[model samples]
Target: MKIFNTQTKRKEEFVPLEGKRVKMYVCGPTVYGDAHLGHARAAVAFDLIRRFLEHEGFHVSFVQNFTDVDDKIINKATEEKTSIGEVARRYALSYLQDMVALHVRRADFYPLATETLPVMQDVIQKLIAKGHAYVGDRGDVYFDTESFPAYGKLSKRPKQEMESLGAQDKGLSEKKNLKDFALWKTRETKNEVGWDSPWGYGRPGWHIECSAMNLHYLGESIDIHGGGQDLIFPHHENEVAQCEALTGKPFAKYWLHNGFVNINHAKMSKSLGNFFTIRELLKQFTGDQLRLFLLTSQYRKPIEFSLDILREKLPLNQRIEAALEYLERNLQVAGLTPTLLYNEAYRGDYGFAATSTTDETEATAEENTRKSLVASREKFLQALRDDLNTPMALAELMNLVKIIQAWNKPPEVKSPSPSIVTIKFTFIILREILDIFGLYPRDSGNLHPAVTHLEKFIDAKLQERTQARKKKDFKKSDAIREELNKIGVEIQDFPNKSTWNWRK
Candidate 1:
């Protein structure tokens, strides 16, 4: 597998430091507010990478940290008149809830900044002892950027350029150099959140928390370190300097950064007043639809956020779902159970098609379809392996759906055959591929309470229509169907039974 490494500015082969075991870390959210679409984008992008790695038979130990005690968290706590811990916990839970709704797999470890304070202090003391950091008169400690000769290597910016940009910022007058960043900030007020450290009562700097946690959790060196592209300059660069300065080893083998999300041709931000939260988007689109929209483009390409784009991609999800449902219905009609097909497909024992001693044309078509299935499966896997090209992978998935839908349209078939078995195999392949992208919906067999109630209500109405028709009450039955139609329920009648679905 190959992935684009931000540090090298090229796609490189991915070989984990430890064979067959991958250590991946992605910068998670600072729990100060609801997670916006930008957060979701980062979360989903890494989630895809993690899932793909696991699917390729790698043991992936993923860690995504929560910045639970940051300036934003402290400010939010003060504004809400609550403790920082309370504010952090509230939003942390909210963020996890959103991740669950989006079907993002939880990381192996979610270390919080507050929980990793001691680790941060240990790293800071080492930096200071090695003369890479110094304590200010006011009990603050700043990293000595000049001490690390390779400071600007990760970001590829000259020291002078970074110094010029850092000089314009306020509140760093005590630093020896403009490019120096804080390792610990001494508490200036009683109300500020802090912890007791060798530098006095202070807190870890924003950049130090990640460096400390990454070391404590995944060791001094890891396979991959990733975050949004915006963090490449100061955040990730500082992390690299601190880790490499302390361990004298490469911080990570590969650096991956996802692209930004834009709204109205501008980057989406809370301050911009155009940000949309994950919860808000979920109200309008299913989790699968949202995942599909996010994966429509390459992971490192910026995506434009708009309802129009979402609407266009939603039918893709619906089409996949409808195809799966059609497969199930056909299986039932042919007296073939999903379990039987599942077992056969799992064993790679799809029975051969009927002999063509009486008809050669039908045999030829079956052979062609079998070949098509094998080709589609190979293409789908190849697309994912090629830097996780989800757009191309998704196209292969749609092709499989078309093949299944075409096979399902028939006059009548009394019994199941190898042809039906082929359809089931195709269905299983598509389902597995969709799952790797985290696009599969939870089984509807476990319905929400509201949906369960609605289903019962609709069943009652259908029962009433059935009773009226049995009694030859044509007028009442027609009235009942008309009422259901008015409420956006479309019913289809069969010789033996009836089914209904929501129209809109």
Candidate 2:
């Protein structure tokens, strides 16, 4: 597998330091508000990477950190007249809930800044001992940018250029250089939350929190370190300096950063009044549809999010679900037992070796269909391996869907249908690929109670309309159809049955 390394500015082959064991660290949110579309994008982007690696037979240990104590969290606590812990707890839970809703797997270790204070302090002391950091006049510790010769290597900015960015915090006058960033910030107000450290009562700076947690959890070096593209500068740059200065080893083998999510061609931000929370979006789009929409673009490419794009995804998601459902229902009607040919235990294998069939021999048409399915599977995996080109992979999946749809259609008169083994194997491959993308069939078993009730209500109305048609009462049937349409329901009539779906 090849990944674009931000530090090298090129795509390179991925080779874990420990063979077949990958250690990855992604920056998590600072729990001050609800998780938004940006957060969802970041989560899903890394989740795809992790899932793909695992599917390739790698043992991945993923770690993400929560900045539970920050200026934002403290300010939110003061504004809401609540404790810092309460504000952090509420939003942290909200972020996790959003991740679950988006089908993002939980990190193996979710260390919090508050819990890693000792670790952060130890890193600061090491930097100070190495003359890479110094204590400021007001008891705050600032990293001495000049002491580290490769300070701007990761960001690729000259020291003078970086100094012009300026500091927003007050300890700038105390720092030896303007480019220097705080390792431990001194609290100005007694009411704010803080912890006792050598640099007085204060909290860890945003950059140091990640560096400390990653070093403590994943050792001195990691396989991959990732976050949004915005963090490439000061944030990740400082992290690299801090870790390498202390351990004198490469911080990470590969640096991956996902692109931003824009709204109306502008960066999504609260200041723009165009920011959207994940919860707000969930009300309109199902989790699977949202996931598919996000994966429609390459991970490193910026995506312009809009309602129209989401609406387009809804029908695509519906088609995939319908195809899978049809495959299952048709297999049952044909009196053929549908077997799951793919198993988790054989994920490392390639081609038909990953799937098994009871019938070894097949007819000419069935063999042709099987070859097509195998080629599609290979194309899908190749796309993912090429730096996580999800758009290409998704196109392959859609192609498979088209092939299945064509195969499921009734054969010509006197023509023999494909073998049951071929049909079952194709279903297995489709489901396995979809599972990697976190798309699952929405069935009654997992439907929300309110939705189930709504579906039952709609079914009853359709049944009533059917009864009206059976009685030859055309007026009653027309009245029932009009009433249903008035409430945003569209019913389709067939010779023997009727179906209803919601109309936007």
Candidate 3:
């Protein structure tokens, strides 16, 4: 696998520092507010990378941190007449819930800034001992940027530009250059939340929180460090200075940063009043559709968010779900059994191998279709390997859907079987690939408990309505349909059966 390292500005072969065991750290939210579309974009992008690595048989230990102690959290607590910890806990849980809605697997560890205070202080003491940091007049520890020669290596900006950018932070004019960032800030107000430190009572700076968490959890070095592209500047650059100065080792082997998410051609930000929270979008669209829309663009490219473009993904998701449903409903015809471990022994293969019962004669008879399926699978993996080109991978997924859809053009008609084994293998490959992409059949058994119960109720009501109509009770049938419609389910009636779906 190859990754585009932001620090190196080139795609390089990925080799973990500790063989097959991968240690990855991603910068998490500050937890002062709800997670917006931009937050969802970064979360989904890294989730894709993590899922693909696991698919390739690597044991990945992923850690994402929550900055629970910050100026924003303090202010929010004060404004709400609550404790700082309360504010942090509320939003931290909110972020986790939003991630669950998006199907993002929880990180192996989620270190918090408040919990890692001792580690941050230890890092600060080492920096001061090494003469890389100094205490200011008002008892704040500032990282001496001038003391580190390779300070701007990660961001690769000139010293003057770095100084100019740092000036925007309103730096203290005591004992250091403008580029020198705070490792330990001194609190000015007694009402603000802070902890007692060697340099007075204050909280950890934004950048130091990450460095300290990484150093304390993942050790002195890690395989990959990632975040949004916006953090490539002063945040990540300062982290490099702090970690390498303290440990004298490379902090991470690869730096991967995802791009921004724009809303209707404008950057999505709270200041601009254009940001949409994940909670709001979930009310109108399914999580799978939202995830697919986020992956429509490559991870490194900016994606435009608009209702029109988002609506286009619904049909794509529907097509994929429909294909898998067809495959499952016709498994008996293809002489296949239902089992997820069709190729459990093929652990490292691209796609799971076909089941043992696949007929060799039928496979030989359907050579052309089988070859097409194999080629599509190869291309799909190739796209993911080449810097996680999800757009191309999704295109290949659609190709598989097209082939399956072609077998039944009119939707109600079943054409001649290409090959029973071919059909079986295609279904296996499609389901496995979808799992790799984190997409699953919504109507399958993966529904939430509440949703599952609701679906069962709907099915029971439909069966009752069918019986009523069979007995020529038109009034009872109409009443059941109205009841279902009141709960946001639309019923479609055919001569022999009725189908229902959530009303769009």
Top candidate on TM-score is 3
TM-score, model 1 to reference: 0.83
Ranking by TM-score: 3, 2, 1
Candidate 1 residue lDDT tens string, 266-334: 888776878988867877776677778999888888999988878988788877887888777767777
Q: Quick one: how many clashes does candidate 2 have?
A: 0
Lowest lDDT sum, 10 consecutive residues, model 1, at 442-451
lDDT of 1 at 204: 83
Each candidate: what lDDT?
Answer: 0.82, 0.82, 0.84
Q: Which regions of candidate 1 deviate over 4 angstroms?
A: 332-363, 410-418, 442-504
Local accuracy of candidate 2 as per-residue lDDT tens digits, 48-162? 9999998888999999999898777878888866777877877887688677777789999999888999999999998999999999888889899888889999879876778
The regions of model 2 sitting more than 4 angstroms off are: 171-173, 330-345, 348-362, 410-416, 443-504
TM per candidate comes to 0.83, 0.83, 0.84
